[model samples]
Target: MDINLSLRHLRAFVAVADCGGYSAASRQVNLAQSALSRTIKEIEDELAVSLFDRTTRRVSLTAAGEQLLLNAREAIASFDGAFLRFQHYREGLSGTVSLAALSSVASILLPPVIFEFQSLRPNVRVSLEDGFAGEVVDSVMQGRVDFGITSLPRKKGRLICEKIAADTLTCICSSRHRFASKRSIEWRDIEGEDFVSFALSSSIFEVVEQGLRSADVSLGNITKARDIGTVAGLVSSDLGISVVPSLVLPMMQFCEYRGMPLSNPVVERNIYLIYDPETPMPPASTFLMDLLRRGPRSKFKIPNGVRWIDYPDGSCQANSN
Candidate 1:
């Protein structure tokens, strides 16, 4: 394993033999003619055989040279392949990175981040597919995509989840709602309200239920919404107050009342970037992750009368940059 035989000698031999002369091989391998000649001579000396028969007018491969040429080419290819692999890691912006995500993210934050990344590195191809929480987690574990961006702390998976953002669930309502003017709210107020929410099968529904039950209250006559946007739209139209992630509130075109910290064990979900530790992430994916990091630009703001409490690593604390 410690043998000193090198790729340099192999390349010199192959180039000289293939190019039919040391001078042509020099240009092929980007070496001076004298250097090329010396390299071949050293290789010949090490092999203890003259590889090429050189004449005043021409040079051609000998029996040993012709035979060794194949192995030399194979060695050169392997070395070139190694160099390519190193290049893959050295610069990540030139490759393709695909991700599986919860559609909710596609509605709010994922677009700007994906767009900025693409604009920053036009060569990198970014693709996203939508799936529910369980499906997204499974995709990441199965190596279906580079990673999954979804609500965090996935209960079941052999996955590493890192919180990329924190999202607070808010009870949104029309401006005419009885409690709409209140600066602060509690889950006790939710006791008598009819709820228009996602189905029990939906992840947000689970979060809402857990928050309500923690407050010793039960929601009445729940209606199922298939998507968050629809849920928000209905809530704005006074269908019933619905709860959703905080990041969603700012982007809504509807003039809806949004607020939070439902005093009874306020339940907030951490948005995590999920990946399988067992799989090797491509460098382009890592570059995207580096772009995902929060910076000094992150701070809590009351966007459209909605102020959220974000954990240190949560999305509200994320720098949109």
Candidate 2:
């Protein structure tokens, strides 16, 4: 026999069995008595088994009906439970959000936001991956993560980059350095100074280099480090000074250093939230994205030398060029 059953058939059969008659089952199922009878008959025909014993006073389930009743109830419960879980996911009450960000952003910018998000939706899990700017972009592009937070990408390609915050480059040096006494130092002031430079792979390096180029100033490159901690360690050792985004200052708090806001061509590093427009973000991911887009001015505290950029409609694309 070719058996094909719809939920309607199973539900009608269960109602008839539970209510013990067509008249009462019709009321429970909101179907006319005649229609309810046809639905039960349809199930029986499909399964090639008589499911009910009809009596003038009462209708009772047969052996086949009794066995199916157990499975049918379990099936309906499982289906409904699945839908309820999906509802929770759609409402951002539960599910996981995977995010990738630059090391500085992951450490300095995301902690409070993640805390607030978890407080609001405790069941929602947030997984964060911290890496260099290029790795952050790659995670978003390869679909390994839901979104990325980083400085503007050199080649944005298909990524939709939205500027979320801006941090001015600050010159960091040992506390005992001569520039520590100055309120603020210009780019030219660091000329001929021993500089601990970031590796070429670092986005900060590019911004600082461009800023130096714009100011027509040069520094004696003492060392190149790939990690921010290494850079901080080197600068703290008084080997040389370094120019880093102000957002990174928080990470260097353990090291003894004085950060002077760089001027004479203030270079601002624009941080962006990037994602592939082709992929649809989940509700949890969308919720977190909205929180980040609101920036520090809304509810989060803005760090020194860093300012939030508010987009008129809550978002705007970066100028990839």
Candidate 3:
């Protein structure tokens, strides 16, 4: 018997078997009734065996037909499953996306994006690493990850950087502290006070120190912490007050800590999405990047004492309220 059977032949045979007759199978296969019958005849001829017992009153499967029916269904299903997987791959819905992100962005901002992304592409695997801003940048530069979420890269080099959010630096203090009741304070207000801030290696601390320098306000007594979580704990314990990004408020250990807007030299750190333009991203990574770009700033609930400082381009404003 000739094994030269096509998918159309297998499909027509399955259609007739399931539909119980050629007339009904024609409609199911979207082929003419006569064409459908001819397809089944060709498949039977290829196998050199009868596949169905047909009569004027009814059509049913014979012993040979029953065996072929099972094999045919299994073959069609396997082909379709492979085709669907390939289609998903071509559409960029079934690959892995690797990302490196700063600790703050990873904890505060990425969970919603990751949740929504997983719901959309359940087959695509997502991997993320949380590190300092410098580490995140290095991962992108070294091709260790697909892209990174961190403070804007200090030097563009070969990377493309786009701002995702502008997080303002605010003073955090124990509720009982003198500055907590104030609506806003300036760099000068915290001068001469004990300061708990980012470690000297932190990019944010560099920004804060530069801002303080421009304002000519100095804190002689200072302690440094590596992450926002530790900085918040220090403020909560009254060990020392600290300045941190507004996103840290949601993760603070103590509800009694107050966030006060710092002015005179308002410091806003722009969070950026950085990728190597020379390296093409996987389809899954591109899809997730689009989702992150389209996320509305209003979705991030701005806590009290934090105001939306509008930029001239309106890109930094979170919401009107």
Candidate 2: count of backbone clashes, pairs at least 3 residues apart or interchain: 0
Worst 10 residues of 1 by lDDT: 300-309
The reply for model 3, stretches above 4 Å from the true place, is 1-4, 20-24, 32-38, 45-48, 53-60, 82-98, 112-128, 138-146, 155-157, 174-182, 235-240, 255-258, 276-288, 297-300, 304-321
For candidate 2, the lDDT comes to 0.89
Assess each prediction's global lDDT (C-alpha) against the native: 0.71, 0.89, 0.80
Model 3 worst lDDT window (10 residues): 312-321
Sorting all predicted structures by lDDT, with the top scorer first, yields 2, 3, 1
| Cand. 1 Cα-lDDT | 0.71
**Model 2 off-target regions past 4 Å?**
312-321
- Candidate 3 lDDT tens digits, 1-321: 339997889898888889889888899889999888888888778788998999996689989999988988999999999999888977878978999998877877888779888988999999999988888989988999999988766655767776666688888898878887888899899888888988976778977877788889878578889867788877877877888877667878544698888998888877777888789888889988877776554354444433333323323312111
Instruction: Give all TM-scores, in the order shown.
Output: 0.67, 0.90, 0.74
lDDT tens readout by residue for model 1, 141-188: 778899887765335356766666656777677787776777657888
Clashing pairs in 1: 165-314, 165-315, 166-314, 166-315
Number of the predicted model whose lDDT against the real structure is largest:
2
